[model samples]
Target: MARYNHPEWHPLFAGYASGPTPLTTGSYGQLLYVTEFDGAPKIISEYFPEILEPAPPMLWSHAQGAEINGIGNPNEVRALTAPTFGEHLDDWNEIKISSS
Candidate 1:
């Protein structure tokens, strides 16, 4: 039985059928990036105290001077903070390119 109104994806959902369904702990990763926001950095951590760690992502600014993977760029690093994005949030458009 299908749950919501995802009739489009319904056909894609196939059953496991006979044998036991194999499962693995989602220790993979799921990062919820909150960029281009004016809220306090601590506020985001406080909201999701359990999951979100303090480690920041490797944003575009890091590619300049910051020692990413123990290597820095020859060009001068741009001045940008987590709260202050180099580009506007609206500038980023959703890219849904599927490999299939």
Candidate 2:
């Protein structure tokens, strides 16, 4: 299992990697739509346990207004309310440019 350094509700600034888990069984294949001030990335993992399924989506929404300026301080990411996808993922802060 991968341990997160910050709270699950906190926004993510950088680093786009799957959490620790087995990829063969698809136990951690849950999808996460992480949105940060920089951009948004969809992370899919198959190693994590099913009990932790809620983390990915929550983390994705929590990273709305999070910004990693130049200094090393994690700021609070604000939440947005739009009417496109769903109520949970309405207003997103960052927009994705590429897939690499």
lDDT top scorer = 2
Per candidate, the number of residue pairs that clash is 0, 9
**lDDT score, residue 98, model 1?**
12
* Candidate 1 lowest-lDDT run of ten: 91-100
Model 2 scores a TM of: 0.17
Candidates in order have lDDT scores of 0.18, 0.29
Evaluate model 1: give its lDDT: 0.18
Cα lDDT of model 2 by residue, 9-34, tens digit? 23433332233445323222232324
**Residue-wise C-alpha lDDT for candidate 1, range 1-100, written one tens digit per residue:** 0011222221111110111223312121111211123443211110111223322222322212212232211111111211122221111111101101
Where does candidate 1 stray beyond 4 Å? 1-51, 56-68, 73-75, 79-82, 85-100
Which regions in candidate 2 have their CA more than 4 angstroms from the true location?
1-13, 23-59, 63-100
